[model samples]
Target: MSLSSTPPNTSTPIEDPSVYLDDPNRKSLEIDTDTHQGPALFRWLTLGMEYLIGAILVALIVSVSSNVVGRALFNHSLPWADELARMLFIWLVFIGAAAAFSRYEHIAVDALVRRLPLRLAHMLYLLQHLIITGLMMVMIWGGYQVLERSSGRSAIMNVPLSFISLSLVLCVIFIAAVSIWRMWVSLNVIRHPEGER
Candidate 1:
């Protein structure tokens, strides 16, 4: 992909790969999942979550690397590394799930929707998002119940297993919020004929 920054007085001819100059300050981009404009709090929360997940990933990598080097050099593995990796992975799975859902990156069959008429397609899209929100709601409740029943500590780290419960709850809540927002936007799209998406 080609990208160029134009000088204040100069304008480049539009050619080659398509470019979207929607936001003047470049706070967000057309190619980014942040293009879905919503509440400021929601956007900031998602942005913060993305950064938090990235940090977790980096920590996981460092933990694994240190553990491996320790094992090879001193013939001893850092027991805490295993638990750290496991916990980080658990958090990653739940946290990354929200971003994926918001960006519509989840696997889905779209051929049927693509074939439908504009109105029907939007309706189906709204219904799909609503269903996703409902499912995530269920998951939140079930996850909470499960967390309530859990009392075990980690085998090596001795940390309470209940710690990861927050991750599950937060992820599902964020996913549900995004689905609801998308459903609202889909309804608006249906009301105003914006030609098909």
Candidate 2:
């Protein structure tokens, strides 16, 4: 076949990691060696608070279970135990969600992007964060409105519904902030001198 007429090969060899590993001349690239103390302290404090709340939740669960068991055996029911358990559960769910958001451990599907090019993958990550942050802001605003409207009402134990609603407001704000922070970190990584591969 003439050189100009030959069909081009469709397959190309993938870049070898060994090239970078074996080359001594290439300078080792370090990303984000400088620690931002404020973010680090916030992260640690948030995690510590989550752990404390988790311990309280465990204690609440154990106490509720014991009360329920004792009441069942004694043919009597504790009126406040169920309500307290429900409130504790609500607290646990919201606080747990906040913790997950802070840690970037929320559920997501990335199967389609896994096969894409690196730049596209990072772009997709940014897009996801943008959507998340927008949604969280909306939720925070809506939750605050609801809390304000329901401030005078009280739950079965005379607890204000607004108090519980405030948790939703806080959770949304925290989720949005965490999403934005993570996006900032990712952008910084992309802009680093040794850009992400």
Candidate 3:
């Protein structure tokens, strides 16, 4: 038999993004939530946040595209387009981050943790979530202070600056809550490893 010269195809198959968006069971979209390991409250909250993020993204696209079209075709810009797009983008980034966190979609290096004993792995997880919660708390406090000092409205849209600051506060609040829940779950697993089975 003659040896083939072709190299093997080792690339992973790419998933269709629209399939997840259109699926009724959105829970399957998440990596680790396939077995219903996440709490019900968070599942609902994540679904709602995903919808909100999608709406904000669509609005942002429309806002920016309309401005571009107006400028190109009419030689004039929509006065409010820039401000509206900015606000939507801010909300999108903050809320998208919270949603991604809930889905455990952020970049992570957990190869070592995966190989460790259950108790030790969970202990590490608890510590990690604790740090995240603490940082989120600090962000929440700082965001509130900014909101208090933000007295002016957006120049074009007449929306209060505090509205923008509120998105940051809300994002951290969701992340902090999720971190606390994860910490509790990790502590439970550490205490009763059998219960996890």
Best by TM-score: 3
- How far residue 48's Cα lies from its native spot in candidate 3, in Å, is 0.6
TM-score of each: 0.76, 0.71, 0.83
What lDDT tens digits, residue by residue, belong to model 1 across residues 70-138?
999999999899889989999999888876665455676666665566666777878887888999999
* TM-score sort, best first: 3, 1, 2
**Candidate 3 structure, TM-score to reference:** 0.83
Off by over 4 Å in 3: 1-36
RMSD of 2: 10.9
lDDT of 3 by residue, 1-197 (tens): 98889978998999997653432222222324446657777887888889999899899999999999999999999999999998999999999999999987787766576567777778888899899999999999999999999999999889999999999999999999989988887888788876665
lDDT of 2 by residue, 1-197 (tens): 65777778988889997653332211111112134323764567466757868796887888698778878798777776777777777777888887766554566454565555554555566677789899998998899789879966444578888877887887788778767875675565455624644
Once all C-alphas are superposed, what RMSD does model 3 give against the true structure?
6.2
Q: What is the C-alpha RMSD of each candidate to the true structure, in Å?
A: 9.1, 10.9, 6.2
Full-model lDDT for every candidate: 0.74, 0.66, 0.83
In candidate 1 the C-alpha lDDT for residue 20 amounts to 30
